[model samples]
Target chain A: MTPASLDLRPLFPAIVVAVTGLAVLLAQAFTPKGGRAPAAALSLAGLAGALVAVVVIAGGRGRGAVLATSVAADDFALFFQALILAIGIVAVLLSTSYLRETATDRGEYYALVLFAIVGMLGLVSALELVAVFVALEIMSVAVYALAGLQRDRPESQEAALKYFITGSFSSAFFLYGVALLYGLTGRTSLALIAQGLRAGGIAPAAAAAGVASAGAATALALVATALLLVGFGFKVASVPFHMWAPDAYEGAPTTVTALMAAGVKAAAFGAFLRVFLQALPSLAAHWQPAVAVLAIVTMIIGNLGALAQSNLKRMLAYSSVAHAGYLMTALVAAPGLGTEAILFYLVTYAAVNLGGFGAFAALTRSGREPVTLSDMAGLSERRPLLAAALTVFLVSLTGVPVSGGFVGKFYLFSAAVRAGYAHLAIIGMLMSVVSAYYYLRVVVAMYMEPPVGEDPWSRVGTGAALALTISTTVVLVLGVYPGPLMAWARAAAGSLR
Target chain B: MALFQAILCYVFGALALGAALVMVAQRNPTYSAFALIVTLVSLSAVFGLFGAPFIAALQIIVYAGAIMVLFLFVLMLLNVRTEVRAPGEGRVFKLVAIGLGALLVGEIGSVLVAARPALAGGFDASARQVARLLFDARYLYVFEATSILILASLVGAIALAKRDPSS
Candidate 1:
């Protein structure tokens, strides 16, 4: 239990981010009212330290488990840790201006965001089910409260309630699945469970007599995967389980929505891919088709749903759902090109999503977000830089050429096609085509339509501007020259054992 | 001693089943809470008969004591009078659920009886074992990390719930 016995260098990134969260709370509590607490700057510094740690430990130290195998620090975890931290940094930057403008600039926002990032960092690395469950809860609870950060607004409260209630139900389903897996395999560690399931026997250290027979284990594994899918499905906001996302996204603060759209989905997908591939690959013949079916329905339904939304946030919510479908398609082809595609696509998706929402959060719209497409009407004539950035994001979302979204979609669909899931790729391509209409409508409104009012648009703030710039640059760089990142993604994706 | 333990197990098991049925069938919320408590206490007794005193104590302390008290207090405080029922809440599904529940109970009972010998051979479930694992195992890190989660949640709850005069 002593620090000397454990090689904790790999866990340093999560520790840095988590400690900074507490520090943010401390600074917030001690600071005098009406005085700046430097919460944003402190979190950014911590995130930078974490990012550097991820790079420094990218070698031999991060390739194994620590803390008695409750969690891992493998290349896969490091890759996602880096991505999650990067997303946090950009999110914090965006939130600085977003909170100040909305008059909800409480210091807890940064601390909560940092905590959520810590959860995500733990989530991708966790090797044990209890750790996964706790990390998931940590991430979920923070976001649940964050969904209601604007306490004065009834919609935010409703969003929080809906999200929390649904989240708890999903967690119950997940825990039940975990219990079943433990009962059947008599192990709690994911790798051990997979070993037990594959060997068709109780794991060596367990009391084998209490465990079910091999035939029964398969049956229980099927049910467990179904239940686990329900849990992960809700988190990723896939179809039939995604009724809450539109409302929550529409009601929550725009920057938080950005993180929800980008970071949460990425983290959940990381866990989903790992759990399925690592712990339940033996059941893939059954689960793969289930995931494929979910992907097909999610892609079709999500695009169709987004077509009906007029509000900017709700549309992105549905679009994120559709993107979840696209990502799930990669799961069907995993342990190979599919894994690489997912790694590449998540970054592109995160960048474009953050860029799109960051552009919206850039301007103070009278203490609230501008909701309708017309809110961006003639935005090229007003904030030209923002208008251009938004256009790029929208274009990227539409998967057009010369954008990150285009390259990501190409890589993902090609991988799906190569993996004999050509049908999924075809359906995904068609839905993405269908998505072009709504996405471009916003772009058209921004560029072609007349201004809505005589009042001048507010200038974009510095922090938000920086956030948007970084996101947009990531999107563009990945679009044009994705060589370096592609190699990194290849290395990370191949490391899963 | 074996005969006595077996008899005790059967008595508490039967009592638990009877109390549970009463809890579900009772119309009054207050009576239902009492019945639930009876069921939980009996269940705890059953656990104690099964040589799991820690779990038995936890069952009584957590579910029967603390949670039931809160349930009763909330029911009394709210002063609820109406029957807690949804109008036309699908009886067919309820019947199906009850039937499936019984089936599951039978299956689990059979499995437990069959696996009693294997389970009896497992390592000690003593408090010392749990404490050692909590500290000696890496679960200590998980325990520590969970605090941050709790603290963050507490902060969030306060931030969202508290009234601000400035606003």
Candidate 2:
């Protein structure tokens, strides 16, 4: 708690992004009417600078327990920070042309994106519960606004309202969980809470709530764990808590939906892993069954829901929910290859979802977004390359061979099986098979069916083309050779305190 | 004295819950805002009974005082009318909401029974100690982070609420 320990280096990544956000706001303000500021480019450069900051300070002093353990810059943190920054880069790239096409290109769009990245970086690195909550709020509030950026659209407004209300409820659940844990252990730091829980020393809590006995402590811990799970479940769009996701995803601008599916989910899973693995490892026996049940229902319900959707965005939203199920299975097998699998799966998932949404965005013609399967008919004959890109992403979502999703699911299910949750692996595999039916339906539409009308697809813009290339390259590279990323994931899993 | 404190806690807790329910059910935006104030004040009183007078005062000063003023100002600025209420969502959605509400009630019930509020002698939650924690301790990082959260929300609110120039 010494003043000397209050170093700012560990926070450079977030600060750099925040400052860039302000710069974006200024750039927007100074631009002449009818002229666009380089808001998207500014966001990309800021993310690049933050990426460099994450690398330069990776092993620096005061990184392990920055600001006396409110946050940490450990390997686990650096890994997610780099991944989140990369996701931000692609999101900005995708938004450049997509936003302009939809006439939603505003400076606040980039600024809010940069701020959300700041939140994601902090969420992954925070060691204390309060810091995590604050970071989560920063991310969610920005995204809620982004969801409704097209003010002229009623659907967009509805999306924003639904997301904000449901998001606030989830945040309350999380805050209550934090309060319960602090009451049970008289601590906020994850490591100290684990220590207190392990020692069976329920410290004298603050004035509001306290546990008087061991039994009471255990009850409180279980309830807190459930509440935390619900909070994260809502964020990741798990089944039963995913009611708002389809509407929000379908209503928002497609590029923003891409960021929601990719960046927001990645940030949630990162904190979800840290909290469960770091603070509640000792209570594994009590919470593991709950997570297992959630994974099962999420996978079953998510894939089935997606099977019923013809709209591309709603289908992807449900598919994202199903992927959350697969990721939670890794949580069931804590502190081992399961941890590594999640980190690795998150990367591939982000790349694929961004690529999928990017391709979906390219369907804009005359400012109208064509989103149905019928609209995608004979896409291979029209925009052959775009159709091919969407095909690969869909194949990846289906867990087909020579795709990143295949490898990621392999590791996830294998880890689940290894942890004696063979039922989880079995259900996961069955669900992936079920998912193929809906995912490939898009492919069949693109390749086999005929276009419904004479309307042609929009040309792929430069920014979107670059983002697609990056995502496609990453997906293919991970599919063919995932050794480097796997090693990084292993090191990160090892560094969890 | 302990009996009196427990009774007061229940009363305030019930008031908070009832007011929250009323806020949700209110069709008028202005009436909903008033109900929210009732809930916030009841919760503040409950906090006072728990010996956390600092937080109790903060609940009133920040939420009931400053934030409520902003809410009312926005309502007035919008010059909103009380629209006719539409029927609820589909039957399934309504059923799900009711089920979730019951579950939430059960959660709160169990939490209340399992973890009771008692005055701990060791902790100092007075304004001075709270300030030191926010200013000088690990919480300094958290306190600073909230500014970023607030700034992001400010920008977000403007983005969402502003009228289009062309319109």
Best by DockQ: 1
What lDDT tens digits, residue by residue, belong to model 2 across residues A1-497?
67775777668899999999999999989999878888888889999999988888776663464657788888898999999999999988888777767888788999999998899999999989999999999999999999999988898999999999999999999999999898888888999999988878477553245446788788888889899999999999988899999999998888889989998998999999999989998899988999899999999999999999988889998999899999999889877899999999999999999999988786675568868888889989888888888888888888888999899999999999999999999999999999999999899998999877785677888888989999988888899898999999999988884
Write down the TM-score of every candidate. Answer: 0.93, 0.87
Report chain B TM per candidate.
Answer: 0.82, 0.71
Q: What is the lDDT of residue A57 in candidate 2?
A: 79
What is the Cα-based lDDT of residue B126 in candidate 1?
64
Q: What is the interface RMSD of each candidate, in Å?
A: 2.3, 2.5
The model with the greatest TM-score is 1
Q: Write the per-residue lDDT of candidate 2 for residues B140-164, one digit (tens) a residue.
A: 8888889999999999999998988
lDDT of prediction 2? 0.89
Cα error, candidate 1, residue A69 (Å): 1.8
Query: What's the lDDT for residue A133 in model 2?
Result: 98
Q: Which ranges of candidate 2 are over 4 A from the true structure? A: A59-65, A206-210, B1-60, B68-126
The parts of candidate 1 lying over 4 Å away from their true place are A1-3, A33-36, A59-65, A202-213, B3-22, B25-28, B81-86, B89-119
Top-lDDT candidate index: 2
lDDT tens digits, residues A1-497, model 1?
56578767656898999999989989988888778799999999999999998888886555654667777777788889999999999998898877877888888899889988988998898878878888899999899889899887788888888888998899999989888888777777888889888888454433455544566667777888899999999999999889899988888888888889989988998988788888888888898898899999999999999999999888999999999999889889887889889999999999888888888787655686777887889888888888889888999998998999999999999988988999999999999999999999998998899988874456888888888899889988888999998898898887776
Chain A, model 1: TM: 0.97
